[model samples]
Structure formats: structure tokens, C-alpha cells
Target: MSKRLSVETSSAAASSLFQQCTPFGMSIISAGFQRSAQLLEMSSLHPEKTREQILEQADQEWIPGTVFLVDVDRSLAVQHEGQSDIVLIPQPSKDPNDPLRWSQTKKNIQFAILFYWSFMTSVATNWNGPVWGIWVEIFETSYSVLNDTSAVCWCFLGLGCLFLQPTAMTLGRRCVYLFATLIQTLGNVMGGVAKNVGVLYGVNIMTGFAGAPCDSLVQISTTDIFFQHERATRISLLTFALYSGSYLGPIAAGYIVENNRFGWRWCYWFLVIFFGALLALQVVFMEDSTFVGQRENETEVEKEIIAQVISKEEGQVYVSASSEKDQNVTVFEEKDFAAPLDIPTQRTYMQRMGLIERKYNDKRPWWKIFIRPSLTLALPAIVWGGFVYGVQVMWLSLIATTQSEFFSVAPYNFSTAAVGDTNFSSLIGCFIGMFWGGPLSDKFVAWKARRNNGVMEPEFRLWFLILPAIINSGGLLMYGLGVNAGVHWILPAGFGMGCLGFGMGSGGAIVLTYALDCYPQLQSEGMVMILFLRNMIGMGFTFAIQPWLDTDGMVTTTWLMFMLSVVFNMSCLIFIMWGKKWRKMTKNLYLKFSDPHFFL
Candidate 1:
């Protein structure tokens, strides 16, 4: 097709051409439709005299995540990124308002908001770690008591998604993100003035409730603005933001606690200040990424037909009228064709900044969306993802719960500032790990896809995960064992913490990317289920940590954690081996969940 849809054609001729075009589903989730095997059988112009005519000819068929990425034949019509053969997945539509067609400057601004939000959410939750000792003294409570409050907070964090995500789906990402920030701001005010454990409990619970989006909503927002190919790198950067805040928060908290003038309470105040500023930036600049396109009124079959005809017209794929006699033929004769002219228009700035850009024909009630996570939990892939990510959280929670107790009393006799400074090691490790897992992994998968004749399997990325599994196990041993052995502070504080942070950074990012890839249509619900289970698991581990350490001591507990990390992380092998098989088995279930519109 001609690059410009402005080239008009006769209505009757366009109708006849569309009728002959094969059926393919439009995701309604993207500007460019995501092509897959789910395409329906359709009538063709070619006749079936002795045998059926196959208009489409290919050396190999494509699958989900698989596309003519290299465009080796270079016959595909859509615009390629730069001069590269890489075809944009979920091809961008002509609509200038489409999120997929957004300018780089616009995308960066959107991404910055999400990245900062995730970063601050993590920081707010973890900054309290360094101050736990001081709080314990001031509140006349034990470390175990404070840890229990945190366990409850984890529960709130997980459960918070049940309410917030559906509202995001019903309302729009803009409002939910802003509300989350507001809640966090108020919770910090509560925390800054907590005079007793009861008040801190409220603070912890409120923070947990507000912080839920860190695990799920930010992910949904990321996917809204990025394509499948660009997702890994972007998610990795956001993952880095999450961990940077997590590890860095304690460092800041430690310094604050050590300084009498500013004090630990300033930690809460600082969050109030920065996140308040973030909320303001968002109020002014955050535009809703949701794009309601032309297919809103079309039936499934019609939508698919409209979508595929458009794809064929765009030249992403082609059909050849070949039978057994000419089966060896591989030729694609491109012809100029026009795309549908009716497209969504760009919204006014006021409309763009509106708190709710409700989906067109998005009639599902909030309760229907609320219950989606339960159904999603049945998926084996999401369950496994939860366990992997949850284990990573368990390690972080363990550090928060034990950092002061372990470092403050002992041969090392570290002060609050020293304990805080230890976070620098994890921060360094997270940066490196995110590089390896995020960007390197993205390159690795694309390479694999090219080698597989431009076919990409979500599982291609899982192979890289094996390294993280091994790294995570080693880190657990180093941290727990080194701490118990009372080796040099560097042994446990630096190497152990560094490795743990590396695993946390790398493993969490890869697993999240894999899950979303497997079920792009269900990103929100899948994430809701995954984060819920992950936090619950983190909560259970948190509740158990004090007792487990008390009963088993650091040595046995270290071994236990070591085994847990190795086993859960290596579970990726199961998915790596049978993940595709499992996906195939659950295909019907997946379709039912994705419904008329996929998340893309």
C-alpha cells in the first residue's frame, strides 16, 4: 500500500477487496494491529477447481511474538524503524493521536512520570528500614513487633491492587496514578508524626495500600506507551528505578537517623515533599495514554477482517494464489492500497489531561474488572511468575527486617549510617543486573528470533533467566552465612547484599517481561494476580522471618533461604521447558479472559 492513506479508492472496489482479504483480529489495544495465528479462514478471489487455493505463501508460518522482523524479503508495507528490517509490532496506525505513534519527547515525558512514581513508591516503603531501630526504642517496642506491622503492610500493598487497578481500567491511568500519589503523601504525613506503634501501624498500612501500584499499575502504564519490542528495555529501566529507590532509601534513612537535627522523621517528610511535587508535575503534564480507535463498534469477525485487510493493504503480509503445482512459488507483488481513513482525532489539551478518558464501549462494570485477578490466578505461568518475583521480595523484606539487628550488634558493630551505606552495594549491583537482564536480554531474544527465521517465542527470553537463578542462590548464602559467620563487614554487607540486589534486579525484571509477553492481552489482570500472590508470599515470609531466625538461627535460616531461592527461581525451567505447551493448553481460557479487546 502507499505509505499515505490519503490516496482514496472507489467504495465498491474497496468492499470487494476487503471481502477477499483474510480475517485477522484487531487488538483495539494498539494503533497498529497485532498479527497472530488466530486469524480466521476467509474467502479468496482464487477458485478451488480440483483443490483449494492458498493465497498466502510462506517458508514458515508466524506465531505470537513471531513476525517478519528482519523483513528479509522486504516486501512488508509498514514503516520499519530507521533503515532496519525490524517491522514495528502492533503496527502504528495513521492516527497522529495513537500512543504507538507518539513523538519521542511525548513518550519520554510519560515514561518519566511512571518511572518516578514506581521509584517513589519503593522508596516510601523501604526508607523506614533504617529507622526501625530508633522507632523500636522510641515506641517501646521490639524489632519483631515492628516487623509484624510491616507484614501487615505487605498484605495491604498486595490487596490494594484489587481496588486500584479496576478503577484505572474504568477511570483511566491518569486519575489512579494521581490518587496513589496523594494517598502516599498523606500516609507520609501520618508517618512523620507517629507517636506510638498504633500510629505507625496505620502509617504502614496506609503506605502499603498506596504503594500497591508499584508492583502492577506502573507496569500497565509502561505497556500502554511502548511496543512489544521496546518493552524489555523500558521495563528494565523502570525496574532499575524500583530497586534504586529500594536500596537507596535505606541509605538516606540511615543518614537521617544518624543526624540529630534532620532525624529519621525527616525521611517521611522528604517523601512528602518529593512525591507531592511529582503529583503536581503529573497534574499538569500527564496525559491519558488510553487510545480508543475505530474498531469499537465492530464485531469480532468484522474487526478481524477490517484489521487483516488493513494489514494486507499495508503490506505487512501477502497472499499468493498457489496450489500443489506451484507450491514452490515465493513471490509477493506489492500494490498500492489505501488504509481506512476514519481514525481517532487528537484530543484537546484539557481533554487529554482529564482525570478519566473512559474506554469507548468499555461497558464492563468495575466489579467485573475487580474479579478478573481471581480468574487470572488459574494460569500456571502467572502463578510461577508470582513465586519468582515473590521470592525476590522475600529477600528484600529479609534485609529490611534484619539489617539493623544483624549489623548493630556484633563483631562488626556497624552504626546506622554504615548500615545505610551498605545500600550503595545493592544499588551498584542493581544497575549492573538491570543492564544484563533488561537491555542485554532484549538483544538476546531479538537475536534468537532472527536466527529462528524471524520467529520470536516468549520462552526465548527465559534462557537468560537461568543465570539469575544461580546468582540469586549464591547471594542468599553469602548474606545469611556471611552475617552469621561474623566475617569482615565487606563479606556480608558488600558481596552478599550486592549479589542479592543483582538477583532481585535481574530476576524480577525478566520474569515480569516473560509473563506479560505470554499474555499481552491480560497484562493488568495477570499483574494483579502476580503482585497479589507475590506480596502475600512476601507477607508470609515477613511474618515468619523473625520466628524463623529466632528458632533456626542465621545459619539454618540462610540455608533455607538459599534452598527457597534456588528452587523457586529454577522453576523457570518448568515454564522454559513446557511454557509453550502450557500456553497452548490454556489458549481457550486465555481467549475467554482477553475477550473482545486485548491489552496489546
Candidate 2:
């Protein structure tokens, strides 16, 4: 009778262990217990392990809630509780109190720093302005060589644009930030010491490449941090930095170059120092904010408390949703493999080919970024915005070189430094534009959106484009005729600055804001595209301007600019009037190829 009791007691202990291990049904408990026991038997039979060790390994591998286990000899028990049935996982909240969600005052501090950084970069880019005349005298070359060099400068920016996204993907945003600024600062330092045009060009390439990511990263950073409502205001403030730098370059460069002791190289020395300060500040204050995927390593106590806080049904729903997302989609997979559906990926053919051995969304068909209807409307706007931006930026440097010299000789007899002061007018125009255009745009956009029953169409932003159009054309006309007809130079200078300020202010704000509003998710990719076009055109036109003036004279070149300005500005209005209908007709065209979620 005592022997029979011992057998029954052993059977009862085994049954209890089986029930504890299985999460679902009674049959599952029996099956799981049998499997665990058989695994232990197999482990004991192996040459490496004793029976005791086998039983320990089996216990660890067959932990509750574990679906599968491998490397049995090395397996460790995971402390999981509750049934293996679905349960909710907690997610991180988007904290409104984070720096991204800071008040207007705090946010402006960041914007101001960024604006200053942009200003310094622009100054570095355009510092060649006052000295171009010196180059002409030294090289004894036609404007073609100068033009070609300018073309090279802009082309370098395009090359930078092409690679920035790819680099950002691999190296991450902070690494790019640190390296670009460092290289740019070094480039400026080199420029101060450069002896030849070739050296200067090489330095410009470095600075431009370093600065290329600035426009892309600043806008992206803003998007990452700010909500949709605040982006326009922040963008307007930053745009001022971009346009002001061009006008401000000559102010500092002219003053420095005018001093017999300092000379043109002094301008670059200033940039080196300026960027050095910014780099230091960024390193000290900037923190990484990439949202990390939630960890499932919560302790038993934390899990219990959270479970009590959230209902079981809600928890289950959250887990189900979380499991469906590719929160940690590996870079290799994105570049190489196809999704399970056999759908092709959206990367360029070269990108796919480069990672042929790896896999993710690789097999998807290639899709053009600009072909979507929303982006199609956006493309022209981007081109026009870039044209306006490039034209003004180049104009200041060009005038300081070609026109300033003309004004400084014989009858005019203004000093080179005096010629540099002409940029002050443009700078003043930029300030006025920033002041006038920024707030008015915000007001107009909000009001228009409200008037349209809060539907929030992108076209509402274009209404602000018209005034800047007239101002830009009018300013070009004034500046042109003032030079050609030789009116009291101030008349044309003031008009030129006013019109430029007007155009730059309105043009920069609206184009950027419109782009952001239209494609909130793809803001970074779209911004890079905008910079690509704008810089390309700006570079092309800078070289083209002097030749055009030399070949056709100031009057013809100015008039041509005026015509282009009017035609493009008018095209913006046409799109604004009909763009909503077009967007409705072709929704998610980009979705057929690229995952819109990646951008979001």
C-alpha cells in the first residue's frame, strides 16, 4: 500500500508541472509535457551531457510562453508569466514636453542657432563675390571661365544632394551632422590659406558638400521635432537665414577686403571661426531623438502593474498592431530583398543592384519621385522656388563682381569697399522681406484654410506667391535699367533690394511651407529634391548671368529674367486653382511603388 502511494504522488507532481507549462488547453499541456520529457531524454543520451544537466537544459528551453528554442545546451530560462495567449505590449508616447514640443521661446533658440549656422554657410559660399573682380584681373580670362567655375560649384551641390540620403541611411543623422560640420569648417580654413583658383575650387567643393546636408537636415530636424501647425513659422524664420546670408556676405567681405591688412582671405578666416563655434555648440547641446523601438524586457512586477492599468482587450489590440509593424526593418532588407507578396521595391536600380545579395523590398518596380500628381504640382513649384532663390543669391555676388567695378571707375569712382556696400541694400531687402512675408504668409494661409472650411488644400499657400512675383520682376527691371541707363545708382539699388527682399521673403516661405503641408511624411526627401534643383539652377544662372550680360547686355538679361519670373509665377497660380482636383484624381500614385509609411 505504501509503494502504491509513492507512485501516485510522483504522477501528481508531473501533472502539476505539465499544467503550469501549457497556456491553452488540457490536451496542449499533455502534449507539451511529453515533448519536454522526450527532449530531456535525447539530451541525456548525447555524449556531452549527464542526465541531471539534460533535465536542467530541458527545463530552461521549455519556459512558459516560449514558442521555440534553439541551442539547447546553451539555453537559459526566460522569466515570462501569464498564458501564451495574446496580450498587449506598451508603446512609448510622443511627449509634448520634449524639446520638439517646447514652447515658442525655446524652439526659437534652436531656430536662431540653425539660422546663424545657415548664415555662416551662405557667407562662405558667396564670399567670392567681392573678389571675383580681382580674379578677372588676375586670370585675364573671359567671363566664361568664371562662369564655368560657378557651374562647378553648383554641380557639386547636386552631387552632394544625390549622396546625402544614402549616407544618412547608413551612418545615421548625428554622424552626418558631426562630420559635415567638421569638414566644412576645415574647408573654410583651407580657403583662407588657398593660393590658386584650383585650390579655391577644391575648398568650395568641400564646403558645399558639408553645407549641402545643412538645408536637408535642418528642415528634417524641424519636421522631426515640430508638429504640422508650427513648421511654417519655423521654416520662415530659417528661410531668413538662407536668403540673408547672401546679402550679408558682401557686407562683411567688403569691409574685410577693403582693409589693406585683411584682404579677401579674411572673409574665409571669419567663416572658419564662425563654423568652429557652431560645431562646438552642436556637439555640446544636440542630442539624438530617433524614436527607439519599445523593448519587451519588462520585469514581472512592471508587467503586472501595467496589466492592471490597461484592460486585457486593449492590451491585446495594441500587441496585435505592434506585431504588424516593421519597426526595426533592417537596412539590408530595405535595400535588397522583396516583400513576401513578390512586390518590387522602390529604390533606384543602382541601389538594388549594389545590394543584390541582401533582401527586403528589393524586387519592387522603380518609381519616379516626381511623377505623382501631388508631387507633379509640387515639382514646378520647387523649380520656380529654386529659380527665384538661386537668382537672388547669385545676383548679389554677381553685382559685387561685374556691376560694382563698372560703378567704381572714372565717372562713378566708388571704392571697391563702397561697391561691396551695394549688398547692404539687398540685405536690407531681405530683412524687410522676412519681417513682412513671414507673418503675412502665416496669417494668409490660416485664413484661407479657414475660408475653405478647413479642408487644408496646398493651393491656398500659392496666393501669397503673386505679390513676390511682381516685386521680383520689378526689382530686376529697376536694377537692370539703373545699370544700363546709368541713373543715380541709389534709385536702382533701393528698388532692386526692395524687390529682391519681397521676392525672397515670400518665395522662400510659401514654397517651403506648401511642400511641407502637401507631403508631410516625405518632407526630407522632398526637401532634398528642392535643394537639388535650386542649387543646380543657381549655379547655372550664376555663370550664365555674366555671359548673358556680356553677350546681350544688362537690359536683355534682366528682361529675360523678368519674363521667366512672370511665366513661372503665373504657372503657380494655375496649379493652385486646379491642384486639389488633380490630387483627388490621382491619390496614392507614389504608393503603387514606394511605401508611404517609410516617409511617414
Best-matching candidate per lDDT: 1
* TM-score for all models, in order of appearance: 0.83, 0.67
Off-target runs (Cα >4 Å) in candidate 1 are 1-70, 77-79, 292-341, 359-361, 596-600
Query: How many backbone clashes are present in model 2?
Result: 10
TM-score of 2: 0.67
Worst 10 residues of 2 by lDDT: 63-72
Q: Report the lDDT tens digits of candidate 2 across residue range 404-460.
A: 556666556666677667777776776766755567766665566445433245677
Write down the TM-score for model 1.
0.83
What is the RMSD, in Å, between candidate 2 and the native fold over all Cα? 18.1
